[model samples]
Target: MDDDRTRGAGERIADARKARSLSQRQLAENSHVSLSLLRKVEQGSRDATPALVAAVARALTIDVTALTGQPYDLGGRHLDPLHQHIPKLRRALTYWDLPPDGITPRPSAELVRGAEHAADLRRSGNHAQLAALLPALLTETTAAIHTAPAGREREHAYATLTVLLFAAHSVTYKTGYIDLSTLIEERTHWAALASSDPVLGALAAWARTTSLLQAGSYNIGLQLLDRAQADIPTGREPGESVLRMSGALHLRAAMLAARSGDSDLAHDHLGSARRLSTQLGDVDHDGGRYQLAFGPANTGVHVVAAAVELGDGDEAINQASQVRITSDLPKIRACHHYIDLARAYLWTGAKEESLRCLTTAREIAPQQTRHHPTTREVVRMLIRLHHRSNTQLTRMAGWIGHDA
Candidate 1:
């Protein structure tokens, strides 16, 4: 029985590697395991210990149970990408901010490799691991940028730094760790170096505006976005299927203004984005960040959220109901959609419908507290409303460990 089980595990691992289009040697190299070990494991000549199983799992970007065909529940695991690592990053930033001589410069090759590894982790959706490594990665990237020799190397370093900042922002909004102001300042400094490269300027501007908007500085975000849009040179038609940078900037600005209580401004900005999106056809030419500006369910969902914030629950619910959730999309967005619908129902005094929506949201995104900011906010509102009416929101509160 033991032999059969061991062979089955080995076969599964081999199949998974093949399915991922990775050679044994490639898997070995990526996993930091010896080729001999990998071969032995795949051939069923060796039994994988827990450490080896873990190493293989990490290499495959999966949990150990997945390789073993055993069911493992991640129910108790906190799903928030930023929760565990953000604190570590805060500590690392403190350490890095110390006296100049207190820090030791790491090898340039190692720094570059680390940044690449973080990028790979981000792409793999292992955002928790990416967040944990981000502080060290940022420190190394910063050091590399400062010490890099003039020309292409420096440009590469700057590009890497920008990528890291954007990744960090994706995991958390308005976390004090990433200095939005300083990033804008650095962009200005680097802009002088790449004055001839309009694309690089646009990328920097995109990052700056995104960070500012995420930090809730809507006015500053709008100003930066406006400047970026206006500076887009005329008669420079970017090759096919790309929305102009101006349109992209306006789209983001619209979302920011909507979230910041400026409904009129939001509508104006979104109108420009929609018109430009129609003209552009499919993709953003400048950065290719978003393919379709308002095609995704997320676009309508954000509009719903903005409407809800503006006390238009009827409009919010109507819009929220129109969004279609797909398996391919991030689970977080679906979670937001249901929660928004619940809130909309609650505001319109439809308690039973609201509860039903909340239940659905909780099931789809079980670890809602860790994943969605709006989840907790909606729960709190529901609890308060029930409390005022001398009714109990026990089930809703229970989803997030709150007693109502």
Candidate 2:
């Protein structure tokens, strides 16, 4: 293995600190992280958690991706081929206001079906296929919106485009295209508002909170979610769509609260999500119409994720054991659950079990697994723990461009 090139977030953090002329103690104090923990991370003896990375990034006044090394292009055979489609997707998103000349979109019903198929690809974790489909779909949908009549036809076109844009955003964000993802989010909000659907608008707001969470702006993130919930009428006898979107907001809020160290507030948000899930009952599809899954199973997934964010590995494991993850659940969500489990087990000193969970995640969704930062962190930790060579683990590490 090329040890010199095997730099991780910790190495990057250490270098950033040194370049800024800040000592380890000073960096830890400014970031509000424990000095010992920061030292271990810098020495490559520990994994850098998202919370720790975010806190450190804020103190350094750098984007989290700067430390995490996002848009990680190893230019190797193991990286997902989906990166090739990013430029096309960017152009498609850029030309939302200008439909390409001489390109006629399909009929309304056909476009709707295409959009639904795109959503299905996203839910099933077929991101490569979804990425390939986005540029054309974006162009065609934009054309439909441009040429459709001013009344119901235009609204329907905009609605279809909104869902497609959301799916596009999902692919871009997961592949580490943060800037493109932000642009897609902006386009989605515009499309959602133009669609005249309150629920879609709320969905946009829910998605927007992701940026706030990454920036460690927990309080402002909570306020945005609160405003989104208020926009949706949640009085007695609210419809299922409203409940689904509201429940999703709650799940996101739980994540933000947990990362901010407010365990009590995080649990409160999870409780509200549970109540909403009960009211919604079992849904036929993972995401259904809203493109955001919010049922008992999904809520359980959030609980595990929030526990991990709060650094409560035991709670995460306990919650995960009871969460019935069925086949119909979105592959991305199920894959994420396993990723969380891997971390939980690692934190609890079950190194082999943690490796097993990561293997399961790779089996469920190879593309998403390969691109995820946490996957890389866990693999690095596993390598550090097992000084002896293990072929399977080393190969897994190599898949994510980490030579261990």
- Indicate which candidate wins on lDDT: 2
Best-fitting candidate, scored by TM-score: 2
Superposed model 2: Cα runs more than 4 Å off: 1-5, 282-285
Candidate 2 lDDT, 1-404, residue by residue in tens: 44433678999999999999999999999999999999999998888998899899999999888888887764654456788888888877777777778889999899999999999999877888999998998898899999998988898899999899889888877877888788887888999889888888888887787777777888998998999889887678888778888888899999999999999999999999999888777652455668988888889989999999999899999999889987767899999999989999989989988999999999998888877888988898899899688988988887778877
Q: What is residue 130's positional error in candidate 2, in angstroms?
A: 1.2
Candidate 1 residue spans exceeding 4 A from truth: 1-84, 91-127, 172-217, 232-235, 239-246, 259-261, 279-298, 326-339, 352-373, 385-401
Tens digits of per-residue lDDT, candidate 1, 116-153, equal 66645443345466778887777666666667678877
For model 1 the TM-score comes to 0.58
How many clashing residue pairs are found in candidate 1? Answer: 0
> TM-scores of the models, in the given order?
0.58, 0.96
Candidate 2: worst-modelled 10 consecutive residues by lDDT: 71-80
